[model samples]
Target chain A: MDIIIKDLCKSYGENTVLDSLNAVIGKGKITCLMGPSGEGKTTLMNILMGIEKADSGAVENMPQNKSAVFQEDRLCESFSAFTNVKIANDSLADDTIISHLEQVGLGDAVYQQVSTLSGGQKRRVALVRALLAEKDILFLDEPFKGLDEDTKKIVTGYLLNNTADTTVVMVTHDIDEASALGADVLYLKDGKITL
Target chain B: MKNKSKIEKTIAVAAALLLWQLASVIIGEEVLLVSPFKVLVRLSELIFEKEFYSAVAFSFIRITFGFVLAVAVGIIFATAAYRWHWAETMLWPYMSVIKATPVASFIILCLIWLNSSSLPVFISFLMALPIIYTNMLAGFKSTDTKLLQMADIFRFSFKKKLVYIYLPNIKPYFISACSVALGLTWKAGIAAEIIGIPDGSMGEMLYNAKLYLATADLFSWTVTIVCVSILFDKLFMKLINTMFKRLEDL
Candidate 1:
C-alpha cells in the first residue's frame, strides 16, 4: 500500500517546517527526499516513521514495521557488528549475517565492536542492519554520508541490488545518489514538496 | 614497564613494613602495639586452628549474602526510579537518611529489631543499597537518546534493549559501585559483629582480644580481615571484568 500524506504541517516553537504539505509514497519503490539543510526532509521522514508528531496533518497507510538508517550511525558502540545487526533480527542466522557483512566489505570486523570501526565502516554496519531487518518500509537519512568515491559506488550498487523490490525513502543532498539508486527525487522546499 | 612497577611496589611495601617495625620497637609496649613479626606469627598459628576458618567463613557468608541482596534490591529500585519520576521523589528522603545515618547507629538499632546473627547482613545491605542505587540510576539517566531512538525504530525487545543498550551504559556504574560497596560491606559487617558480639564470629574474637589486652591476637585478626577483604575484592573484580570482557567479545 502506498503511504499518503494529507496536509501535513509541523512547526517548532516559531519556525514552520511543514506547511500543509501532501505527497504519496509508492510501495516497493525507491524515493529520495532531496533538499537544502533545515528544510524538513528529515522531519517528514520522522513523522512517517512515527518518531515525531505533526502539528496538524495526517499520514495514512504507513507500514506497521519500519526500519531506518538514521543520519547518525546509531549502532551500539560496544557490540560487535554481528551483534548490532543481530539486535534487529536475533532469529536470523549468524552465517547469514556474516554473508551480509562480507558483502559490505566488513568481513574482518564482523566480530569487532562497532566503536572500533571507522565512520564509513560504522555507516555500512547500520546500512546492513536496516537492509537485513524484517520491515515493510525502509527509511534512509543520509545513510551513506562518509564513504569515499570507490566505497560509495560499491555500497550504492549493493543497496540498489538489495533494495530493488523494497519500499525505501531516502534523504540526501547529493542528487547523484538519487540517480545512482534510480530513485525518484522529491525536493523538499519551504515546507512544501516538489516531485 | 611491568617489572619496574612490580619492583616499585615491593620497595614501597618493604619501606612501610620497616616503618611499622620501627614504630613498634620505639613504643616498646606490647599492650599498645604488637610488632609485625609477632602479628605474622600469631596469624600463622591462627590459620592452623579450626575456629579461625569457621569464624572467617561465617562472617564472609553473611556479609556476601547481604551485599548480593543489596545489589539486587538496588538494581530494582534504580530501574523503578528511572522509569517513574514519583518513585525517585519518594526514595529521595530514604536514600538521604541511609547515606547520612552512621553505621554504628544502624547496627545498634537493627540489633534491637533483628536477631544478632542477622545484624551484620542487614547492616551491609543498608550501607550498600544507596551507593549501588545512586550509581546505577545515574547510569540509566545517562543512556544515549540516539541509541534509544534506534531501538524504538527497530522495535527491539526488552531483552535486546537491555543487552545492547542498558548493560553497556550501566556496566561502569555497576562495577564501580560493587568495588566501593564490597569494601564497605566488609568493614561495616565486621563492625556490626564486633558490637553485636555474635558467637563464633571474627568480630567476637577481636573483642575478646581487646578485652584481654592481647594485642598480638588483635593484630592477627586485623591482618586476617584485611587479607580476606582484599582477596575477595580481587576475586570479585576479576570475575566482573572477565564477564564484561566476554560480553564485549560476544
Candidate 2:
C-alpha cells in the first residue's frame, strides 16, 4: 500500500516548518526529498518514522516496521561494526554482517568499534545497519554525506540493491545523489512542496 | 601505550620510601606517623601470625560478599527504575537518604539490630548500593535512543541488545561505580568493624591499637587499607578495560 500524507502542518513555536503538505509515496519505490537547509526534510522523515508528530496531519498506510539512517551516524560508538549490525539483527551470523560491511568498503573496519573508525566508515556502518534491518520501510537522512566519489558509488549501489523491494525515503541536498540512487525527486521549499 | 619501564616506577616508589624513613628519623617518634619501612616490617610480622591471616580472611570474605550482593541488587533496581518512571520516583527518597545519612550512624544502628560479625557486611552493602544504583541509572538514562530505535526495528533479542547496546553504554559507568564503591566499601566496612569490634578482624586490631595507644599500629593498619584499596581499584579498572577492548573487537 502507498503512503499518503494530506494537509500536514507542523511548527516549532513561532517557526513554521511544513504547511498543508500533501504528498504520496508509492509503495516499493525510492523517493528522494530535495530541499535547501532548514527545509523540514528531516522533520518530515521524523514524523513518518513516528519519532516526532506533526502538529496537524493525516498519514495513511505507513508501514508498522521501519528503519532509518538518522542525520547523525547513530552507531553505538563503543561497539564494533559487526556488533552494530548485529544489534539491529542479532540472529544474523558474523559472516553475513562482514559481507554487508564488505559491500560498503568497510571490510577492514568491521571488527573495530565505530568510535575508532573514520567518519565515512562510520556512516557506511550506519547505512549497512538500516539496509540490513528487517523493516517494511527505510528512511535515510543524508546517508551518503561524507563518502568520497568511489566509496559513495560502492555504498550507493549496495543501498540501492538492498532497498529494491522496500519503500525508501531519503533526504539529501545533492541532486546528483538523488539521480544516482534513481529516486523520484520531490522539491521542497519554505514549508511547502514547490515541485 | 607508553613505553616507559615498570622498573622505573618501582624505583621511584622506593626512593619515596627512603625519604619517608628519613622523615621518621627526623621525627624520632613512631606515634606521630610510622615510616614506610617500619610499616613494611610490621606488615611482614603480621603476615607471619596465624591470627592475622584469619582476621584478613574474615574481613575479605564478608566485605567482598557484601560488594557482590550490592552490585547485583543495584543493577536490577537501577534497570527497573530506568524502564519505569514510577519506580524511579519511588526510589528517589530512598537513594537520597542513603546518600545523605552518615556511615557512622548506619554502623551504630546495624550494631544494635545485627550480629556484630555481620555489621561490616551490612554497612558495606549499604554504602555500595546507592553508589552503584545512582551511577548505573545515570548511565542507563544517557544511553543512545537512536541505537535503541535501531534495535527495535531490527527485532534484536534481549541478550543481543544487552551485549551490543546496553553493555557498551553502561560500561564506563559500571567501571566508575565499581572504583568509587570499592574504596567506600573498605572504608565503611572497617569503620563498622571497629565499632562492632568483631573478633579476628582488622577492625579488632584497630580497636586494640586505640586501647593501647599504639599509634604506629594504627598508622600501619591505615597504610595497609590504603594500599589494598588502590590495588583493588587498579585491578578492577584493568579488568574492565580489557573487557571493553574485547567487546570492541567483537
Candidate 3:
C-alpha cells in the first residue's frame, strides 16, 4: 500500500518544519527526497518512519514494520560491524550477514568495533543494519553522507540489489545519487514537495 | 611508560610505609601507632588462627550479598523510575534520606529493628542503594534517543532493545556505580558489624582488638579489610566488563 501524507504540519514553537505538506510514497519503489538544508526533508522522513508526529495532519498507510539508516550512524560503538548488522535481525544467518558486510567492503573489519571504524565504514554498517532488518518500508536519511564517490557507488549498488522489492524513502542532497538508485525524485522546498 | 608508572607507584607506596614506620618509632608506643612490621606479624599470626577464616567468611558473605541485592534492586528501581514519573517522585525522598543519613546513625537505628547478624546486610544495602539508583537512573536517562528511534524503526523486541541498546549504553554508568558502591558497602557493612558486634565476623575481631588495646591486631584487621575490599572490587569490575564484552560480541 502507498503511504499518503495529507496536510502534514509540524513545528517547533514558532519555526514550522513541515508546513501542511502532502505527498504519495508508492509501495515497493524508491522515492528520493531532495532539498537544501533545513527544508524539513528529515522531518518528513521522521514523520513517515513514526519517529515524530505531524502536529495536525495524517499519514495514511504508514507501514508498521519499517527500518532506517539515520543521518548519524547510530551504531552501537562497542559492537562489531557484524554484530551491529545482526542486531537488527538476530534470526538472519551468520553467513548472510557476513556476505552483506563483505559486499560493502567491510569483510576485513567485520569483527572490529564500530568505534574503531572510520566515518564511511560506520555509515555502511548503519546501511547494512537497515537492510538486514525485517521491514515493509526502509528510510535512509542521508545514508551515504560520509562516503567518497567510489565507495558510495559500490554501497549504493549493494543497496539497490538488496532493496529491489522493498519500499524505500530516501533523503539526499545529491541528484546523481537519487538518479543512481533509479528513484522518483521529489524536491522539497519550504516544507512542501515540488516534484 | 607503563612500566615507569608502575615503578613510580611502587616508590610512592614504599615512601608512605617508611613515613608510617618513622611515625611509629617517634610515638614509642605500640598502642599509639603500630609499626608496619608488627602489623604484618599480627596478620600472619591471625591467618594461622582457625577463627580468622570464619570471621572473614562471615563478613564477606553478608557484605557481598547486600551489594548484590542492592544492585538488583537498584536496576529495577531505576527502570521503574525511568518508565514512570510517579515512581521517580515517590522514590525521591527515600533516596535523599539514604544519601543524607550517616552510616552510624543507620546502624544504630537499624539495631533496634534487625538482629546483630543481619545488621551488616541491611546497612550495606542501605548505603549502596542511593548511589546505584542515582547512577543507573542517569544512565537510563542518558540512553541515546537516536539509537532508540533506530530500534523502534527496526521493530526491535523489548529483549533485543535491552541487550543491544540500553545495556551497552549504560555499561559505563553501571560499572562506575558499582565501583563507587562496592567500597562504600564494605565500609558501611563493617561499621554496622562493629556496632552490632556480630559474632564470627571481622567487625567483632576489630572490636575485641580495640577493647584489649591490641594495636597490632587492630591494624592487622584493618589491613585485611582493605585487602579484601580491593580484591572484591577488582573481581566484580572484571566480571561486569566480561559480561559487557560478551554482550557486545553478541
Best by DockQ: 3
Per residue, candidate 3 scores C-alpha lDDT tens digits across B63-106 of: 99999999999999999999998999999999999999988889
DockQ of model 3, rounded to 2 decimals: 0.81
DockQ of all models, two decimals each: 0.79, 0.61, 0.81
* Native contacts retained by candidate 3: 0.88
TM-score of each: 0.96, 0.90, 0.96
- Score chain B of candidate 3 by TM-score: 0.98
lDDT measured at residue A191 in model 3 versus the true structure, 0 to 100: 79
TM-score of chain A of 1: 0.98
Question: Would you list the clashing residue pairs of candidate 2?
Answer: none
Clashing pairs in 1: none
The superposed Cα distance between candidate 1 and the true structure at residue A177, in angstroms, equals 0.8
Q: Which ten contiguous residues of candidate 3 chain B have the minimum total lDDT?
A: B148-157
lDDT digits (tens) for residues B1-250 of candidate 1: 9999999999999999999999999999988988999999998999999999999998999999999999999999999999999999999999999999999899989989998889889999999999999999999999998889999999998877887899999999999999999999999999999999989999999999999999999999998999999999999899988987777665
Q: Is candidate 1 or 3 superior in DockQ?
A: 3
